[model samples]
Target: MVLVPLLRGCVQLLTLPIHVLAFLGVWDPLCKTTFPYFMSRFARLYNQKLHKEKQQLFSNLADFAGASEPLSLLEIGAGSGANFQFYPPGCRITCTDPNPNFEQYLLKSEAESKHLHFEDFLVASGENLHQVADSSVDVVVATLVLCSVSNVQAVLKEVLRVLRPGGAFYFLEHVAGDRSSWIYFWQQIYDPTWKYIGDGCSLVKETWKDLEHAKFSKLNLQHINAPFNWTPTRPHIIGYAVK
Candidate 1:
């Protein structure tokens, strides 16, 4: 009981500088510029660690587009195009991210992922994908995104709106751990600071619950621990939902 408050206070003290930068209105632009660079480097290791799980999650992607048509994929929060390698051959991918700084890194990833076809890189948020037409995509992918979205339900709704009938939505997201665990307790203590430092990511988002109620015709989701040293990001959910 006593340790919880002490830990929370320590987290707040550690993040005081970030809060000050945010108050001065320097944080957003600074984060937009620096985060993409950091993610470009970090994503390589992250992709390697989760390679097997990502392979299994994406194995069925080619089936979604059928034998004749090329797969059309829209990836929300597609930072640095980390998942590009996992996508099946001949996939026409449209990537969206709120931070335009990622375009350079995404282009580099696209160049490397020759098996996949590169489309447009849209500067948009998952909640409002107005640039993308309704029911136009064969697949919508969101990895480690739901945690940061201002409205998870709205993002899910937009996902449903943009996916064609029988189209699939694949997701792999870090989520809150069991309430009784010490990790969950620490997640609560660290979340506020984590959000600012992690570019609005929440350590305690029970995203599975929102997915459950999102009206997907077929939801095949499961919980698993990701191969991350960071405890808050270890608890994850991976699977796909079909419209």
Candidate 2:
């Protein structure tokens, strides 16, 4: 038994670099292609249950923010552009992501949300959203993006800086839990491997603190204790607030 565990540790150690490269897209023979496709495919199914809940949350946010019509929306980490269909009336949504696979979904969203016709799509990353003007957006959405950003602090700062006064910052992300010993263990074991597989996804960060430190005006938070499929330790936290 000791030898078996030791051998497994050794295997993981040896494959660490390979896993990192694959997760970071450095070792892709297809040049960083197909990985996003695979990830989007995975998200399409995994996120289906959460979508309805998210729409409700967004509706709540719309009411809380009093966004009637022609609201400006900037969404970072626009994975698969699934949220496009949820944009409220007269909303000008600017969905952004570095992944080209999301463009088709964005177009589909544009077609679906006809009332949200004033929409734009950008191929970009959260680290540098230079295309968007500072302090110009009325609403900022960072749903599930903090878990994967290269610099969570920078992204939060950007979100804070861009959002106008009374504008809301909506997010629904998986966060580290207080009582997940099994999740903690799996996180320790597969944390390094997932970094390579999920484009720098981290199961360790306490994102709640990051949001708190952003210094928003009206703070609202809700922690969901749902177990994840990949691991039981990491619980998904879904909620939002204003700035």
Candidate 3:
């Protein structure tokens, strides 16, 4: 009886890749309708662990920007508006995502909250932020976003365009790792599977190099080993830069 159950588990694990591969070429069914729902639910569950890091990053950004409350902030690729929940009080926050489904949960959450008021939610992409005015934003935050953007260089240019002089752009991202043969071997095999299931995430992006090439003013890069409750993987390179 135990052998039968164990064998079933093993089979399920083996077949997960097939399911993931099917979803790769096809647009994510989740992105169509269930994306926001899944994101909201997952955010609530994952927020406790992830939010602390986000808050810490935000604090660092505030210090770097030398701004207090009531600051003009833009969060590009702000899925499900998780950042709003952690933002400092008395701020006019603008959160944008390409997915329209994000409006329901994001707007609803803000409506019920007294402190975190959102200015708007628009359908926007990082590569091209149309509505945001140039040199108007004090701080631009991108957390775990670049790996999936279609054009990273364009996105940085857009970010640089929007940010006010002496403003900060903060990031928390995992990049492609060093030349560790073991890590490389596994990443090579499973990268496709991971990207398929986790949207357009890439384990091979040289995030640090890209940022350096972008020539953002006063760039500082830091690497922190992200807490892994599951399996060991590459360390995340968290970045903070001024424009």
Each model's number of backbone clashes? Answer: 0, 3, 0
* Residues 1-243, model 2: lDDT tens digits: 374356547657878777666668676544346556775676666557677667777885455333444677888877776676566776677888877666775666567667775467788888788888877787888776788888878887888787777788888888776644566555655555565556667877788888888778877788776435656324776667677
lDDT for each residue of candidate 3 in 1-243, tens digit (9 for 90 to 100): 374346545554776755654648444655447667876776665567666676766775445333445677888877776666666776677887777777888777787667865788879989889899998888888876898788889989999999888888888877766656455444555555556555667766777888998868788788766665352245577767888
What does the lDDT read for residue 67 in candidate 2? Answer: 42
lDDT values of the candidates?
0.91, 0.70, 0.72
List ranges where model 2 is wrong by over 4 Å.
Answer: 1-17, 20-25, 28-31, 64-68, 230-234
Best by TM-score: 1
Tell me each candidate's TM-score.
0.96, 0.82, 0.81
lDDT of 1 at 70: 97
lDDT of 1 at 211: 92
TM-score (C-alpha, index-matched) for candidate 3? 0.81
Candidate 2 Cα deviation (angstroms), residue 230: 4.4
TM-score: model 1 vs. ground truth:
0.96
The true-versus-predicted C-alpha distance at residue 124 of model 3, in Å, is: 1.3
Assess the local accuracy of residue 27 in candidate 3 as a C-alpha lDDT between 0 and 100: 49
